[model samples]
Target: MKNLIRTFALVTALLLPVAAAHATVLTETGLAESKVAASETYRLNVPTEKAVATTQVRLVIPAGVAVTRFQVMPGFTRTVETNADGLVTEVTWRGRIAPMEYARFFFQARNPEQAGTLSWKVYQTYADGSVVAWDDTDPDNTPASKTTVK
Candidate 1:
């Protein structure tokens, strides 16, 4: 019996990492519009699971999209980086974020002479340096999101 219990425990431990890799929260909403013009602002709202004094928040701007501006409200520090192509590949916000607290991130950009769904992964960093990626199909990662252009 002792040997059997030990074996089961080992198996569970081995599977734990795999489970964590799969452990992601995704807060995604359907795109409200199929067409967004070149001149407009798009918005998305995301919340933290176990709110951490946020150390940083990173947003990736995919190819074919131009980011003109990124804004964070009252209590956050932000950084924006553009790649050689002059497109924003990363936008990071640094600050404290309490668990269950939500923040809105907005950006103005123009589509790169093209039109379609523009998608990218976003990551949230906790005060402890732990990171939560808003990816995968986990509903917990799902956040309020929208697209707009005029």
Candidate 2:
């Protein structure tokens, strides 16, 4: 009985962090300033340097929400990627986002669990084949924003 109890406790402790990662948002500076509006339409915008024709963008969505709609600004192409389950893994919002330029996407997020915090990570692929990963931490050493969503 003692061993079983100890094993259960150890397992629970190990799983707690993994569970929290699902809810915790890691916002890294992708290329510019970004923000999330709590309105019915969850809006996101990332302003960063332009990507070469061969560049790829890796935009990750927060675990708690679903991306109902996604669009990219004109002058560039875009693609949406999904997991085998058909769930969106990442939306490759492409196009040469002009240096000091901004790109945006919209989504309809449902918070049935009434979760508090919403977050995700984003990575950028440059035209030269370089990669920039932003999981909500400042990659370029920029400050990240967090909020208490009601």
List, residue by residue over 58-147, the lDDT tens digit for candidate 1.
Answer: 777656667787655667777788787767788887666566566666766665555564555667777777876665335444322223
Q: Give model 2's TM-score versus the native structure.
A: 0.55
Cα lDDT for residue 22, candidate 1: 20
After superposition, candidate 2 runs with Cα above 4 Å error: 1-39, 49-55, 136-147
- Regions of candidate 1 where Cα sits further than 4 Å from its true position: 1-31, 34-37, 137-150
Question: Which residue pairs does candidate 2 place in steric collision?
Answer: 26-135, 26-136, 27-136, 27-137, 28-136, 28-137, 52-127
Query: Per-model C-alpha lDDT, please?
Result: 0.59, 0.51
- The TM-score leader among the candidates is 1
Which residue window of length 10 is worst by lDDT in model 1?
A: 21-30
Query: What does the lDDT read for residue 8 in candidate 2?
Result: 100
